[model samples]
Target: MIFIIDSLNLREHEPLVKDMFRLRKRVFADRLGWDVRVSQGMERDRFDDLDPAHVISVDDEGRVVGCMRLLQTTGPHMLSDVFGAILDGEPPLRSATCWEATRFCVDTEVLTGGRASNSISYVTSEVMIGAFEFAMSAGVTDAVAVIDPVMDRVLKRSGNAPHGYLGTPKPMGKVTALAALMDCSEERVARIRAFSGIDHDVMQPHRVTA
Candidate 1:
C-alpha cells in the first residue's frame, strides 16, 4: 500500500521514514553512486527539511520498498537551488500549481520478483500513481521531476512519459539529469493504471497538508 507522509505527521511515523532514508542511501549513494549526503547510513539533504510530502510504498509485511518526495515549486526546490545547471540559464519554474518531485528510489534487493505487487515494477508504478494522485488532490496541475536518462526511459515504457522538458540533460554524478514536465490528469493516471494492471486505489486514507 501507499502512504503519504509529510512534516505534519512525520513524528508519528519515524520508523517508516528512517527506513525510507536508508533505502535511498542504498539506491542513490551506494548503488547508483550518486553524490548524495549519507550520514549514519541514511541519505538526506536540505530539501528534506522543507516539509515535502513523501509518497512511500510498503509491502504486506509493512516494510518500505519504494518512495518519492514532492515539494511545491513556489518554494526552494532542487531544480531551483541544487540543480540549476539543467535549466541552461532559463529561470526555474516556480508556481503554486507546479510541484517538484524528487528522491525517487525503490528497494530492488527485496523486490526481486516479476511484475507482481511485490516486484520492483509494481512498486514503482504504485509510487508514481500515488504521487500523481496526491498532487492532483492538492489542486496541482503539473509536476516537474529531475530524473536521469534511465528513469526517463522507465517513465516512457510505463506509459507515464513526460509531456515536456525544461532543458537539455546535464551530467550528474554517474548519470545525466534532466527536468521533465508531466501533467497530473486523469488520462495519464488511467494509462499508468492500465499498463500496470493496478485498477484499485493506491493511496491510503490519510491526506497530506501543505
Candidate 2:
C-alpha cells in the first residue's frame, strides 16, 4: 500500500520514514554515487527539512520498499535551487499548480522480481501511481522531476513518459540529469495502471486519531 506522510504526521510514522531514508542512502549514495549526503546510514539533505510530502510504498510485511518526495515548485526545490543548471539559464519553473518530485528510490535487495508481484518494476510503477494521484488530488496540474537517463527510460517503459522536457541533459554525479515535465492527469494515471496491471486504488487511508 501507499502512504502519504508529511510534516504534520511524520512523527507518527518514524520507522517507515527511517527506512525510506536508509533505502535512499543505498541507492543514491552507496550504489549510484550521486554525491549525496550520508550520515549514520541515512541519506538526507536540506530539502528534507522543508517538510515535503513523502509518498511511500510499503509491502504486505510493512517494509518500505519504494518511495518519492514531492515539494511545491512555488518554494525552494531541487530543480530551482540545486539543479538549476539543468534549466540551461532558463528560470526554473515556479508555479502553484506545479510540484517537484525527487528522491525516488526502491529497495533492490528486497524486491527482485521482474514485473511480477512485488518486483522492482511493480513497486516502481506503484510509487509513480501514488505520486501522481496524490499530486492530482492536491490541485496540481503538472509535476517536474529531476531524473536521470535510466529513470527517464524507466518512465517511458512504464507508460509514464514525460509530456515535455526543459532544457538539455547535463552530467550530474554518475548519471545525466534531465528535467522531465509530466501532467497529473487521469489519462496518465490510467496508462500506468494498465501497464502495471493495477486496477484498484493504491492510496492507503490515513489514520484518524481522537
* Model 2 pairs in collision: none
**Residues 12-49, model 2: lDDT tens digits:** 99999999999999889877788889999999999999
For 1-210, candidate 1 gives per-residue lDDT tens digits of 898999888998899999999999998888878889999999999999988899999899999999999999989999988889999978899899999999887898998757788877789889999988888888898999988888898789889999999979998878888899999889999999998899987877665633
What do the candidate models score in CA lDDT, each in turn? Answer: 0.89, 0.88
Off by over 4 Å in 1: 207-210
Candidate 2 to native Cα RMSD, angstroms: 2.2
Listed in order, each prediction's TM-score against the native is 0.95, 0.95
- Best-performing candidate as measured by lDDT: 1
